[model samples]
Target: MQLEITGHHLEVTESMSNYIREKAERLKRHFDQVMKIHFILEVEKQRHKAEATFHVNGNHLFADAYADDMYAAIDALTDKLDRQIVKHKEKVKDHHRQEAAQLVAATETTD
Candidate 1:
């Protein structure tokens, strides 16, 4: 998976970049098919915002968070993305199970 981090209206320091990368790597544990992840960090007045777009296989998942601290915002964003990835995995599993059941039923009917 590719990770791209960009900052808007703020300079992305080395420590911050490393922190983001480390947090993002955790996602791979849940879903290995992640193709690309793009993160955008922005600071507007007192709000520090973090947003990420994830490309997993053929699906796109996105989440954003706002907090008073940049690290907190990134944490929130990752948590949201993790939940979305788990949900997506469940949906895909359920879809394949449903399809297999339907196929078995059709074959039994023909037999």
Candidate 2:
């Protein structure tokens, strides 16, 4: 998976970049289908905002967060994305399992 981090109106320091990369990597543990992740960090007055767009398989997931600190914003953003990825994985698994069960039942009836 590819991870792209961009900053708006703020400089992305080495430590900040590394922190974001580390947190983003955790998503792979839940769902490996992630293709690419684009993160945008912005500072507006007193608010630090973080937003990310994730490309997993054929689906796109997006989440945004705001906090007084950049690190906190990034943490919130990742947590939201994590939940979405898990939900997506569950849906895919359930769909395939249901289809397979139906197929088996149909084959048994035909035989």
Candidate 3:
């Protein structure tokens, strides 16, 4: 998956880039089909904000958090992203199950 990191109102550092890349890679342990991740980091008025968008097949998941530290915000956002990915997975699975059940029922009727 491609990971794109950008900073607004802040300078990008190697440490920050590595950290984001690590966190983004962890998503693979949950859902391996993630196509890309876009991370936006911003700081304003002593508040650090982190936003992450995950791109999947025909689905998009997003999470954001704000805290006194950028690292903390990134941590919280990753947790939120995990939950969103899980939910999306469940929804997609449910949709396919429903479709499969309908097909099975139609075949049984014809038989």
TM-score on alpha carbons, each prediction: 0.85, 0.86, 0.83
Which lDDT values do the candidates have, in the order given?
Answer: 0.95, 0.95, 0.90
Pairs clashing within candidate 3:
none
Instruction: Tell me the spans in candidate 3 whose CA falls farther than 4 Å from its real position.
Output: 94-111
lDDT of 3 at 95: 79
- Residue 12 in candidate 3, Cα distance off native in Å: 1.3
Ranking by lDDT: 1, 2, 3
What's model 3's lDDT at 101?
A: 93
For all the candidates, what are their Cα RMSDs to the real structure? 3.2, 2.7, 3.4
Off by over 4 Å in 1: 94-111
Candidate 2 residue-wise lDDT, 1-111, digit = tens: 999999999999999999998998898889988899999999999999999999999799999999999999999999999999999998777577889999999999999
lDDT of 3 at 27: 74
Off by over 4 Å in 2: 95-111
